[model samples]
Target: MAERADAARNRQAILQAADKLLRDHEPGHISLDQVAATAGVGKGTVFRRFGSRTGLFQELLAERAARLGAAVESGPPPLGPGGPPGQRLLAFVDELALLAAQNIRLIAAHERACGADPHSDPTYQRWHRHLRGLLSELRPDADADFLAHIVLGGYNGELVRRITASGGVPRLRIAVRDLAQRVGDVD
Candidate 1:
């Protein structure tokens, strides 16, 4: 039990170090050696724990996504909980737009480097399906899943690209609000 606890602590330390470095430098620029050195561990330990750079990045993304999930869980009203379904939908897009703005570069690098199954990820899949369910509750007439995908694809997915192209967040929230109103008004 003591050994297990020590191992867990060591892993957390390594992850923290890696996360710091990733935030400080571009993901591609940082190496496993830096991560191990920052964590005060041997390079072998990093390899043994994460296998490769891609694996480490995956862990980092999972860690970030976990934190993101927690934030959504405990965040303010219309996001965490306690709001009308339509409001919640808009909140999701607004929050997602913010996240993309914050992590645009790292995310672009991650998308290029890892290119893994985005939908297969549990967190993403859950959010996608949950939004569909909520949209259905908010508007029973439309095809919930398709409509959810359209909104996410049209509004959220384009946020990073639009921000990069425009050099800002733009009026994303307003556009999303208007889009949501239009969608909700559909019979």
Candidate 2:
């Protein structure tokens, strides 16, 4: 069923409020009450809509990844469907590195929220599937499933943040791309 107009409005308000708060404050420091107050909504509404802090962060991460998901599903070459597997692997890693670099706080928050089971998250599962498919195509002899997770290990948000803090996104991107190429290259 379609969301009620007022519900949609409130959701947007809550999300906007959360986004604004996240930009200035650490996620651990932000609270539902604060978000509700910032959005001019009630605390119960925030709780009802988001369930919990982890759920809210998950939604935010999903929103951030949606465009990349769409591009990988159907947009254009490299990041999309038309490029060769190696080029697409490079592009995918490049974009993910950039996203992780740019959204360090959000990624960090989500990582903390997810704790030990990030593989269960939908956005991550989608990206993992895509990477696995590309790797399988590029390396029929390798264990594509294991290799996909390995590639993703390097893209872990906390790791990405640490790497970017020192060497920057450019260096991170190059390293990840090189990793993808090395792992996916046929022997």
Candidate 3:
């Protein structure tokens, strides 16, 4: 389905405003009224576009995450499609760490507000699956699906813990790369 020109414009406006708000305020602090004013649209329009504040936040966060994903999918050799398997795998973690660090509060709040539908959202499941596929490609001897789950789960745990700590992201990225290498090297 395609959006009409006016609908597309309005959606962009709202997303832009939400992006700015995410930068200025924690996700816990944003309200629909504020988003409406920021987007220069009416409250009704906001509701029409997004059923609730949570919905708006979900869309915003998903959009942000998708943008990061797209960058990793297309922008560079290691992160994208050109690098060797090992380099690409590490690049995924490094990119994810950067994204998590940047949007930690927003992500945490969304996870809380959204109640985190594990095994439901394709995004969550896709990352794990993709990771597993990559590892499987690199190491044909291992149980790729299981390895993907373990590695992704561990990386996410570390990401949540370090989103705000001093130098947490950089250190964690290094750890992630080392861990990934170890997983790959296991033959």
Candidate 4:
């Protein structure tokens, strides 16, 4: 069944409201009531649409991840599939670092949304799969699975937040790039 026009509009409004709020406030500090008010929809509408605070934030993270996924699928190198494996792997890790630094709050919310086992989250799984595939291509003899997980560990959300808070996004980017380079390059 198709969604009604007003329902679609409400969903857009609610999503926009959440995006706007995230610019200035952490997810924990923002409320569904505030979202509904900014969206000009009823509080129940927000609740019914998203189920809970985590649900709402999860949807937001999913939207952003989908955009990144699309770029990785078809956009230009070194992010897309069209580039060399080593360069593409470096580019992908750079992107992840940037995501962690720029969207720390959303990352925290997403971490919470996934509870204790974030490795099982679809977003993280997608990233891991992409990284593993690229790592496999870059270093055929290396353990791509473990390598991908280790790459992700370096930009763990809380770690990125702390690093970025201390004004270290540039260093983080460089370190991640160097790590990817070293891991992909055979001695």
Candidate 5:
């Protein structure tokens, strides 16, 4: 039990350090040595815990996705359960766009390292299902699944990065709001 607790503590430290580093610098620019130093752990500990940089990225993605899912499941506001379907959907898109803007560098690095399609990822699938369910509530006769896919395209990391780089986060949020409005009108 002590060993397990120690392992958990080490894992949390590593994750916290990596998350801080990723927030300060792009994932591609971060090294495991830096993570280990920040976490106050040996380099071998990071390797033993995560296997590789790609594994570390995957874990980070999963953690972020889980947090987002929890917010949508039980948190307050338009992104949660209290709002009208249209408002909730729009809020969801806006939130997703912000998250994509914040994490695009890490996400892009994960994609490059794993060569996995973001759309097919389990986390993305959950988001798609949530959107589809909301769309179905608004327009039962329409193709909610396809519409969800289309709506999610606006929140893609690459698109968010380009828009924000060219303009800013506010511009990207405006674009996302525009897309959400159009999507919400698909009844």
Candidate 6:
């Protein structure tokens, strides 16, 4: 029991250290040695906990995706349950774009390691399903399923990072709002 508890503590420490490193430096530049050192654990501990750098990144992305999912499912309005469909759709897109921008490096690393399409990610699937439901409400006659994919396309990590790098998140938010407004309109 004590050994399990220690393992859990070490895992948390490694995750926290990896998160800090990802945020402070480019994900491509981070090494397991750095993470182990920062977490005050042996290099073997990190390998035992996560297997590889790709595994570590997968865990981080999964953790972040779960938090975003919880926020959209149960948190306050606009992103959550209480807003009008159009408003919620707009807020959701903005939030997704912001999230992608914030975690671009980590996300890119994960995609590269897995050789997978970003649209196929579990997080993207949930957002696509939620947006499709909202789009159906906003425009009953439109192809909501396809439109959800279209809306999400605009929030691609590289695009969000490029646009925001030039003008910042406020500009990215405004662009997302404009895109949402266009999609939200039925006629």
Best by TM-score: 2
User: For candidate 3, lDDT tens digit of each residue in 1-187?
Assistant: 9889988888889878877887788767877788889988888888998787667767776776796578556877777877787878888877776666676766665565566564344555667766887898899999988777667654443355663375677776776667778887631
Evaluated at residue 120, the lDDT of candidate 2 is 88
lDDT (CA) per prediction: 0.67, 0.87, 0.72, 0.83, 0.81, 0.81
For candidate 1, the 10 contiguous residues with the lowest summed lDDT are 152-161
Error of 3 at 171 (Å): 1.7
The true-versus-predicted C-alpha distance at residue 146 of model 5, in Å, is 2.5
Output the better candidate (4/6) by lDDT: 4
TM-score per model over all chains: 0.69, 0.92, 0.74, 0.84, 0.77, 0.77
Model 2, residue 29: distance off in Å is 2.3
- Model 1 clash pairs are none
**In model 5, which residue pairs have backbone atoms overlapping below 3 Å?**
none
Total clashing pairs for each candidate: 0, 0, 0, 0, 0, 0
Instruction: Please identify which of the two predictions, 1 or 6, would achieve the higher lDDT against the true structure.
Output: 6
Off by over 4 Å in 6: 1-3, 31-54
Q: Which lDDT tens digits does candidate 6 get at residues 91-116? A: 78777777877787777666655555
Candidate 3 regions off by >4 Å? 52-54, 71-76, 139-143, 154-164
By lDDT, the candidates rank as 2, 4, 6, 5, 3, 1
How well is each residue in 2-87 modelled by candidate 4, as lDDT tens digits? 99999999999998998888787875688889999999999999999999777787788778778788889999998997788887
Give model 6's TM-score versus the native structure. 0.77
Instruction: Evaluate model 5: give its TM-score.
Output: 0.77
Candidate 1 matches the true fold with a TM-score of 0.69
How high is the lDDT of residue 129 in model 6?
95
Q: Candidate 5 — what's its lDDT?
A: 0.81
